[model samples]
Target: MKKCCVLIPYYNAGDTLLSAINSIDYDYLHPDVIIVDDGSQITKAADVLKEYIGPLNIILLEMDSNKGIEHALNYGLSLHGRDYELVARLDCGDLCKNNRFSKQVKFLDENPDCYLVGSWVDFTDMDGRKLYTVEHPSDFESIKKLMFINTTFTHPTVIFRSNILDSVGFYPTDTPAAEDYAYFFKIIKKHKASNIKESLVNCTIDPHGISTIKRKRQIKSRILVIAHNFSINKYAVYGIIRSALLLYTPRGFTVFLKTFFNPNR
Candidate 1:
């Protein structure tokens, strides 16, 4: 099978960065793991690179200052993206399940029409306690419809074709905290997208992570995404209502409601 690259944005990731890097099945993926350091002054990503020994090609790109994840991601992709046919994403703390990269690459390779593929993820607490699993739609039609409500692909669980950049471009800075939501929405509208039917990664739920810290901004951004991609349909109307409603609710409530009704999870 052909090789793929992985994009990881790190800022004060500490040991979780190591866990994320170590989880990749290097031999199978033969990954060019590009890590962008978003000015991590404390508990740096470089600290892990210094002590590690591995077969995977781990490239580190350091920005002059902190510009947030969107900038770091685009920086990495702008320079390293074209060299590979596929790009996979993993956050600093997420652990790739066995055969995750291989399976994703193989799926994209065999199914030429599918531009993006993600997997269900296992969410865990800081102590590695199981929180919940998020299962996304596996069919293109369902994904396109459900995306109106929320992003179907968990960012960390996705591996997408590089050429889609030609159609959809890089992650949009305008989306603020919900760039992936907007980007994935663009792809599904233009091409087929789906998820593998099983959990392919373990994503630790960081209480102070960007999703939590910028919860409100993300929800507002989701509003913009939904409005911009608006179409007249039952799911679309309900999606707008759900996202707008989420803006008023606390993050805990939204998380609880989603977990309680995970839709065939």
Candidate 2:
């Protein structure tokens, strides 16, 4: 069996932490779970995790100060050498489907050339009720369409090969909000990437989440997206124009616009 582990970077999640952990059905693919607390102010977050303590390798590494997600992720990755073939990412508030790890592991095992693998996801409200499902591309050509806009391949649903980290390096610390987007562009440009075409994760859309509330972060993310990915003047100009327009519209409207204008869509 291929060795795999799930890395979760959490901050002030409180009771939601256990739900995230429990959502992954480890019985199918028994992978180690590493949770790094990113200076959460809530004391109960730590205490709540204690309830689910058992034989599982649920290691908790706490940081004294908030180091941001990139720092927390890099810290988690530093724990293991090259023994593990795959490293799965999970967020503190999101939940993985029952066979998420098992399916991702099997996909990686079969498709050795692919460095990164993600799955489709269902967006849910804070109450855990499903809002709608997101379908992602499964092949390389379709994956390139992702450059035009980000469809739902929630960060938590992605499982990447460990060696790719050596080539791409850790997530760019300078760009916190769109760090994953930056990292994905690097991987797709340099290595083979694809999605599983299966809905294997439930992404919670917390109304108060940083991704939603922080407008400046989203604007900053657009700048990073153009700077890191599109080096050509034409492509960069196009990306900049599109990103500016995207910022003004609601996310739902932006998605619809992309779907209508995008050639692949």
Candidate 3:
């Protein structure tokens, strides 16, 4: 496999960051890892990095202030992504499947037209119990259609070509919590993107995370993303209605629906 590294944005991640870094099967891919500390006040998160002794290089960058994850991610991209062929993403509390990087790297190597690629993810609880799985459409057409209503790629399960960022630019910081959605929207229009059929990551759905705590803002930003990408078409309406329900209804209800009626399952 070509040289690739993982880029992780850290902010008060505590031990989760260390655990996440350790979980990657470095012996298989031997990709260097970079974690940009986004002005985390919690010292433990930063302190734990000192304990990671591994075969792969671990680059830790620091920011003086909390500038949000979008900026932190862009900071990492600007700093180190230029040298690697691929850059994978793994959030603080996420666990990668043993073959995650190998599969993603192989796919990127084989498909040069694909700018970015992601895989299915399993959403788990604090105790690591699987709650539900999110599987995205693998074909570009299905992904584009679904992008209006939902995020087609799992963020933590992605391994994108380095040039894709060069072409599309870094993640937009304007959207706050919805930067990934907006970034993907731009990517889908400019280049080919798809997901692997298998689940490659287990994401911890923290109730207090931005998705739950800032659902209203995220939904609003998603609606704006739809407006920017598609005109007033059927897909736009579907996007609005889907976002409206998530915004208006209680999160618990939406979680229930996702757990029980998730189309991928």
Candidate 4:
């Protein structure tokens, strides 16, 4: 079987980091799980890491000071773990089903044309109550079509081939909150990407998460991503126009529209 490594970047996650690690059924996939401490503000996260006891071969890397998610994720991706055939990602507070890595690896193995694969994701509240499930297009063509509108893949729920990282490069250090969206646009242009029809990961919707707290910044970055990567077409034009319009609206109103139109996302 091919090898895969799990990469998680955390910052001030508290006990949720440990809970996230514990929730993974590592026995099934047997992949090395690497967690990076991106200069956490609280000792709880570091203390929890020190106390972790698990069968999975866990490697912890810590930075000197608090960097944002983009820096932490890029640092994790830069590690030697890329020797594995595939690299999977999970957030500090998300839960992966026992079969997630296995299923994603199988899909990649079967679909050689695909460079990245994300599964349908279950969104839950902080208490783990299911909010809804997000289902994205499973084929490359449809996935590309949706790219101009929004991110088709859930960053934390994705499993991508290792080789593509060198070609696409790491997450943009400058993009900050929209690093994943910008990076996805960069990769999807050169490689095929898709999403599985079934939900394989449960993503916790933390109101305090970077995407929530700095959503307007993320949106602005996304517009720039689309502007640079997309050709002058109807989808590109529409995306640029819509994103620019959203910029002037109140952040709360934009959040409301997103919740109403695409709550699962």
Q: Which candidate leads the pack in lDDT?
A: 1
Residue-level lDDT tens digits of model 1 in 1-265: 2358999999988878888888998776688899999998887788878877867888899998888899899999898887788999999889998689888888988899988999998887789866678888898888988999888999999999888888888999998889999889888878898899999999887889999989989989999999999999998899999988877788777677766776533
Alpha-carbon runs more than 4 Å astray in model 1? 258-265
In the range 1-265, model 2's lDDT, one tens digit per residue, is 3488888888888867788888877787677788888887856356767788654578787888888888888888786625477888988779888588888888888989888889988777778876666778888877765564553256889999989878888887777677787778878878887778878988887767767776458666857776666655554577677777767767656444544564432
Worst 10 residues of 4 by lDDT: 251-260
Which one wins by TM-score: 2 or 3? Answer: 3
Give the poorly placed runs of model 3, Cα more than 4 Å off: 262-265
- Model 4 scores what on Cα lDDT? 0.82
Candidate 3 global TM-score: 0.95
- The candidate, 2 or 4, that scores higher on TM-score is 4
lDDT of 2: 0.76
lDDT score of residue 93 within candidate 1: 85
Is candidate 2 or 3 superior in lDDT? 3
lDDT of 3 by residue, 1-265 (tens): 3489999888887888877987797866799889999998866356978777767688889998999989999999998888898889989989998598888888887998998899988998889988789878999999988898889998888888888877899999888889999999988889999899999999998888878998899888888888778766677789888887777888777777788886554
For model 4, the superposed segments whose C-alpha errors exceed 4 Å read 248-265
**Candidate 3: 10-residue stretch with minimal lDDT:** 42-51
